[model samples]
Target chain A: MQVFKVYQQETLKYFHSIAILLFVTVGVSAQTKTDTTETKKKPTSFVPTGVRVGTDLIAIGMTRYVDSYKGWEVNADVDFSRYYLAVDVGSWSRDYDNGAEIYSNNGNYFRIGGDVNFLLKDPDRNMFFLGLRYGRSKFSESLQVNKIDSMWNNNPVNERYSNSNSNGSWFELTTGIRVKIWKVIWMGYTARLKFGLTTNEDGNLIPHDIPGYGRTDKNVAWGFNYQIFVRIPVRRQQ
Target chain B: MEFGLKAVNLSLQPRVSTMKKATWFIFLLIIIASCLNDPDCFRINSNVIGISFRVMGTGKSDTLRMYGVTTQNTDSTFYRNTAATGIGIPLDFTTTESEYLFQTTRGDYSIALKYDVNVQFVSEDCGSKYVLENLETTGHTFDSIRLVSRTPGTTAGGNIEIFRCPRTDTMAVAFRQLTLSGTTKSSQALVVETNGITPDFTGETLYGGEKVSIVYLPVNLDVDKHAMVIDFDQVEGGLRKLDLNYTLTETQRYRPCGVQIFASEMIINAVESQYAFDSVGFVLNETNSSIRSVLDPFDPMINIYRCPDLDIAGIYFRNRQDRADSTVSLKSVTVNFQTTNYAPTEPTTFIRVPLNKSATNTTVTIEYQTGKIETLVLSYTATPITRFRVACSDQNTLFTNLAVVAQGTTLVGSQVPNASLQSIPTRNIEIFP
Candidate 1:
């Protein structure tokens, strides 16, 4: 009973994540499998035609130039008619010192959802689409605070606090475009409005930032990613 | 060849146009992203809760004098020896529960509160802030407390109002004298000196060795009559008993105040004393149920009056060698050109003579039984004291520092003892002749 009570919150979080994934998969697959009896009369174009694999260039550039930031993200999508299934995986680590305190955090995150291409009939298969994603992160953070209390005889306070094995989740409404420059090489941007953020109660040490969701203080945060991709054809276009 | 080249250019035209548009979009996105900065530190946050006091029956604001209010974990005090109707206190931000100990004049009480703390690290420039919510009173030791607001603010009204019942058993009696102002009559407060006062119901002596014009006497809740004995000074039979009668009505006026006992229809039922009083009347007929001011609780329900005090000093002739009373014969005695019938037909050691209330000195002409007359001068300081208001100003004078400035021939010496003269007569000087 004691062990179950201790892990109850973690178990509930995992259950929610699994429920969202199942809902997305079942909903999309059910939509695609509709009217199969009329497939002989009208050919269905539901089969995946190509896959795009990409890496965020901005994250790489910040990792190289910004002293306090080190992070990278990879994105991939498989096309099914005018709709596509998208997935993202990323890792972030930050170390900051601002005279009064030292804070550091590191985490890994993943996002899975679907996107609908609005520019469906473009000859080059260039895309402008709006999508939704369910993102979850698992991370740990530590902070060391230093202060001098002038009221209490100038007493010096040096206290260290840390939160280990914390989990956070959020949802993102994404809008961007994917443009094809050449036969296989492609470039695009994804602008994300992230909201509905929640996290595990970690006693005292509140997290300054979530790995995939940016700052944890705000209710809604904005993100932009400039990505480069290579398109590999999985089947011949009908 | 010309046809092939033109077709290739046509195919590349849309591709080139799409690339240019994408470049512009990316450039605009980068510019907007670079402008996203952290928020400024401007908001003010506090973790304070307010508490106020009220009287149960009237729901009036009540003042409370607190010795101090402290928490278990900290040495700091919230309000130390501070008197206020409402006060603001801080809740512990580091924990979910807090308990405060209140030390007051009446007794010590405690209140425990439970809440949730939501801390947010806003930005690097703003640092962090905490908001306390779901404030609840888990336990308390006061007579009654009502939670007015769960989400407390920094206002002075406070979130909790503490209630206590008003005092209903005690009543005040004032001493006053009536004087004629031309054709009109007015009463002024008269200070009486007493050894002690004994209430018949409790049989306890109160306010011993003190001078008080107004006195608070308790009403016997079991009966309608309350009597007390006042011990006056320098009287043959010093005890004066006064019996008071009243009617008590028991009714629940307000549910929160509970059943209140009110006394009214007051009557000065009886007076048993050897000495006579000028008048005794009911000034305020009802026992006060509400306190108008915390500082002034005396509302005098009864007014007992005596004739105003006389400006006089008592002197006893004592032999300097033995410190014993000495007798001397006198034909006539005059004080400040006014003759007083104070000297007895026979020789006496003690005499009471009136003083000059407006003068610093008095001339006494003593014609000894030897038929030789001698003029003696007595010097003293008089301080004008007012008891009630400006209308009664200078109605009484306090004489002090009495001395014999001149003793006519045939007197050896004289000494001033107990220089201050009080309403009660005590020996003020001694003479060696």
Candidate 2:
């Protein structure tokens, strides 16, 4: 009888183990099926590549000189994907003498004929992407002065002085990292510096810096460009 | 093992059953909610019942003629007394009558009347009724009556004939009577007595029973003259008696006749101090046998007098006809001048005396180099005047030339050619001490 009892106990234990195993197996299978279905339904490659063709690309970021001045800059980069053409439009203004000197070196700018970067990288993150841009850097200055002399005569006399226009332009080159934050949204930051390959005889290039040349006395100029990009998704397939 | 299984199954069945019941309840609730949200899914029928009455006439007397009526279903038209009846029906009813006799049944009915009638509506416990009147009823709800006719003038004393005559005709009376009151007073003396012989010819008299005789006469005095004048000399008097028989007649001879003179451009030439030529003038030629010649020279003269205060300066004349005639004659020409500062406490005394005899139709012209008169006032002592008018312009100041005819004055037959003065000058006259 003791032997019989032991055998019975073994059989009961074996059946219990089998039942437990079956329950676990079924639950896991159902869970796996649900996960597979969800994964199959997920959309892939939601954003199209090279969609920035022929677009006005605006970027905002901190600009730092490799060997000189540093400040925040905003640049508008225009691209012509057909010809791999690019341009940079930007401006910077600073005033002294209570804004009177604002016209001396500040107003509007345009950069023409710049090299395009099909791919860029973020050094710290080892992130890389492709982009294209063509633009130039330009500056305009306008000054005005007015004077009134009442002590010289019984009637007031007025005098006015003005610089209607003064402008300069340069080509630029830009390169940076392209990062993906969302399915269609891309974030990028670039360090761009411009160079004026030519100059006017009025020493207009004396105070300007070139992008690759740093600061040269040879009439070549350079300027810093930094930018952040936002990519918009076009279409997606599930 | 079977019992345990049965128990478990039963519990599960009950749980499912309750769930099913809850689901059914939710479905029912949804159906109800949907029905409430739909505007066209269901219809509600409600009965709106009311009562109205139609009145035959609009006034107080308008016969109710009918009762307990209903409106026509087709067009809501109402029925009247015998002419129409209501199709028997039950309705909510009320009635009211206005103070203007407009009866309203069920407080909503309107009343209309026939003919131009005034009506008043009265609402009582029994029903509503309208009151009407032929007369214009005001202030109260009662009927009114008006009496109308032409009111004759009051006659109190005796029966006296009344007659209407032309407005221009004059009425006169002649009487002869004898009195035994005294011996020294004669009939002629009584005739001169302004108060005693004068008859009170008022339309109203005081005597109740006494009668007086009166004769009707027209303006034409020639048709019956004998009855107008009475001669008291033919009657004798001891106790005093007289014959009083007279006939009435119409005559045009007694009417006051006068002429109008119109002159144009009668200028007074101050530089020449002489009368200018005649420009325009007319002669008023009329005559009456009643107007006896009072002037011994048989010539008519117009007297002119100037007021002492210089405010009035003109001529005056007396009528020589019967005192009853409203006419006067011109005689003894006189000229009275006036000054702006000639202040006299009484009427002025300046007069122009006649220096020549005037023919029947004599024309005379008086010239003044420089003079001024402020205002002119004319007085006549002849028959009482009935109507008169005066008009003057810059070129003519003469009464005849200006067509200024004096009241109670007649224009005899005479022709005066248009005599013109250079200019009728006017000056601001001043008087000196």
Candidate 3:
């Protein structure tokens, strides 16, 4: 009976794994069907092999506070359609220190990357795109003290402090899916697991996320990204 | 039949959906475009317009006549012309009573007189009455007359007449002298009637001890003239009463009677010098001198001067030409020096002097150190009359002309060889050394 029970448990485990896989597959299939129906109504245009322009929002998560940054991004793939050269410009303001103090940062980001997409199913809609993004993320910080300094000294003083900038190379592998909503509108979600390849104070490869680094954590860190965009197609002369 | 029905249903459903999507997209585009094209705008405020008026006349006590209107519009383009009726007045004069009355009427106006003097009197016909007492006099001797009303009620509609007599015969003689002694010194006591004419009381005073005489003077109702005379012998130590009375007589028409003499005397001597520098490098030693009785001291002026081959510069003494209350006596003389050189030029400089005050009798020396000798000519010019006035009273008509008399000029120094000298006759020339 003990052996029978062990066999039955193993079977149950297998069924459970299969059910999870089926759930993910079916959910994706339903989404794909909707996208296909919408796309079929409009004329298809050639996707440019050399240029890709996109936008993104970065949620800065820290021990004390969290902030968001949103802006546009444009990229040119030079070598084969898989190699990407990108530029991202964005600005963000945050109240991290406390409600009494605030911080803001803004700059441009540039990257040279490569990506590969693998089709999981017969339909091109069920695919996972894996890309390595290598870019220089520059950041600046400006701090403003909204309240008087509360220290041993009775004197009340307000202060404004700022930092010029700091930039470093970053690399990340992002895997996501692209789903078409309308003929021109696209909806996508991605997961990026990144490593800084550069050193932190501990002399080890820094995690992707740090106070000064562009990401929230270092080594083996994962981030979920989402985006909605419209594709403006340029017509070719007959 | 089944196959046909299925085909029709499929085609109709897709067509309707496509049409709906296209229509929605077009509507969104139109709304967004409209919002982007519209914007807010602004405009500037308009400007306000204003008007003003001015009246000109002679003597300190002379009546100033002015008239104007306001159309209640702030437009600068609108204007009113009163040249034909002598009533063109700016809109700003609506505040003054005299200006208001003049603007409403297009006829001549004169200073109404009560006795021999001009006084303000109330009439029953007029809605309100205003009287300005102790009317100041212009420094020069002049006659002043104003409109007077004599009806008992507020509506005095009939013609009002005025008369004049010497102040010595009035009951308020002390008041006429501006002195309040034991008498009440009321101006009302001087009102009297004579020769079927009633005149109001007016004050008159002669400046110098000259004789006062009266002749029929042509009266210009539009421009009334007043003459005041004080006789030194008639008063105690030349302090005589200036009291005079006026009575109003109701007549069919307003007519001023014969001229009545109050007091006659010579005017106080107030002379002014208008000097000009000559081109021959000389200054005006003296200019024209105006003569009158010696009541006030004379004050001289350096009118104008010109450097040799240069410009002429000087200022006319306004005190001497116009009458002022403050005493202006000659204190000292100053000459501004300048020099200029022009080759091959014979410059003849002219200077005018008040009669007998020029440098003709005085020594005039001209010394040349560098330039060649040239002819030097000193010429004299009589002062021309600056202004002419006609004075008219009920019984006296007189014409007064003011002028600057020039004496002569004397030339000094040796003349250059072959240099001709000529003396020219002209008016209003100045040569000062």
The residue-level lDDT of candidate 2 at A43 comes to 41
* Best model number under lDDT: 1
Q: Report the error of model 3 at residue B222, Å.
A: 99
Cα lDDT over the full model 2: 0.25
State the lDDT of candidate 2 residue by residue for B250-358, as single tens digits: 2342122222111111121222112111111111116523311111111211111111111122222223343121222222222343122223233332222211112
- Give the Å error, residue A42, model 1: 9.5
lDDT of 1: 0.70
- For every candidate, the chain B TM-score is 0.51, 0.15, 0.17
- The digit string of per-residue lDDT tens for model 1 on B1-433 reads 3554222222334434544554465456445443443454553234678898877756778788999999864668879999988889877665678899999987998999988765545555655555676789999888789888776442333678887766677777787765432223466787767777777677777777777898887666666433434433413236666665667777785565678776666555545435334456666324744322111133676677754343666767777689789898978777865756566689988677778987899877767688977666789888765542333344456677788899877555777777776545567767665
lDDT of 3 at B287: 54
TM-score of each: 0.48, 0.19, 0.23
For TM-score, candidate 1 versus 2, the one ahead is 1
User: Compared with the true structure, what per-residue lDDT tens digits does model 3 show for residues B1-433?
Assistant: 3554222222233333433443343334334433432211111001111111211121111122334333322122222333221122222111111211223233332321121111111111211111122222122111222323231121122122212211212111111111111222111111111111112122232223332221111111111122222222222222221111122222222123223322112122212211111110111223533221111011111111111110111111122233222221222222212132222133223221212222222121233333222222222222222111111111111111212132223322221211111111122222222
Candidates 1 and 3: which is better by DockQ?
1
Candidate 2 or 1, higher DockQ:
1
Docking model 3 quality class: incorrect
What are the per-residue Cα lDDT tens digits for candidate 2 across A1-238? Answer: 5335434544543443344334334433443354344333434332333333221232122222222122233333322321223344444443222221111334344544433332111111112212323343343322222222222122222211222233334443343333445553544444333334543323211322222222222232223222344433243312
* RMSD, one per candidate, in order: 19.8, 47.5, 34.1
Q: Give, for candidate 1 chain A, the lowest lDDT window spanning 10 residues.
A: A31-40
